[model samples]
Target: MNKNCAIVTGSKESAPYTLIVQTTWIYPGWFAGLMKQHAKVTTLLKFIETANPAHVLLEINSEKAPGDFDFVGIPNSNDRIAEGYAKTAKSLAKLITKKIK
Candidate 1:
């Protein structure tokens, strides 16, 4: 697995370690590239264990970029695909510290 890692800090509060992982997954055209190819419950958990991230900000592109869709508290499985991603994001937050940074 090829992993890309970076430590980013903004202001005093938004400094944390960020990891950019490239895997094999596709969604919409706009945000398809941003999806974590290796993003799985186990994978994310392992990352948290290894990185010990203070605040994990999963971005489709870069830490400064925003997501393609507006996330609202993890979408219903049947509601939308993006919702599921958001849900995964939320769930991952519990195991790891995550926020906009």
Candidate 2:
């Protein structure tokens, strides 16, 4: 299994205001690429619709929020690597960050 490290930080929840750190794994790629796929997006949206949280914090490698995790370190077949997959993951991460706030 390919493993991409994701660090979740900042969670301060009150009765009225809730803060959460949601650490989700994106196998073989970052979060955005995972969501861009039609099937994957559908699945993710379904999960979001079901588990509606107050706030969320996501950690992914991006220019805005550079992550310490390395996608190449994951144990995945070379053939599965897509072009600009990392950016996609970053984009997804951004979306999650927005939803949290």
Candidate 3:
């Protein structure tokens, strides 16, 4: 596990349960082309590395250990994109409620 995951897991000693929410990249819609162009520019400038959606999915899946703590992946939520933040929050709340119950 990574440093962040280690810290979260360690918290299990203090809290009865821990919920880890891993958010994926932004939602790709009509702005796909624009986003791609921006990614290219950022990559060339070394500001950010290109992201692999598949890798992210795999990581989220692998980190899941219901016995240790609850984990959920909220896609299209990497950044607080105004268009989808509400939806993401609702989904997250539902997951958390389900876990707690």
Candidate 4:
């Protein structure tokens, strides 16, 4: 029961906080690694920590980075996944905020 996939945002306005989306059961660390690999995504983690996540998401599933946030092949995606995602996303937000300072 490993739910590694997570879609997170710094905002709490609505369900789709930012442009970030985790459609699969992947880890946030791996997502950060991919973000590091992308040359086009400047201020990548910063943007994720701030606002407007849609811009970086444009390059998410592309060759520059390979990932799908469509949430497929995941059984009972709404169970333990939500809690795990929350924890992971919260940790990432804290790390990003710390790095920005």
lDDT tens readout by residue for model 3, 1-101:
22212122333334533334443444332223224211100001011112422222211121111111112221232222432433433444454456666
| Candidate lDDT (C-alpha), each | 0.33, 0.33, 0.28, 0.35
Which candidate number has the best lDDT? 4
Q: What is the TM-score of each candidate against the true structure?
A: 0.27, 0.23, 0.26, 0.32
State how far residue 70 of model 1 sits from its true place (Å): 16
Writing each residue's lDDT as its tens digit, candidate 2 over 1-101 gives 01222425233342333332233333333345333221111112212111345333322332222222345332332223322244345565566666666
Residues 1-101, model 4: lDDT tens digits: 02322333344665433444444333322224223211111112212422555444332331122222333322333433443444444445554566666
Off by over 4 Å in 1: 1-14, 21-23, 27-79, 97-101
**Model 3, C-alpha of 1: deviation from truth (Å):** 28
**Worst ten in a row by lDDT for model 3:** 37-46
Error of 1 at 94 (Å): 2.0
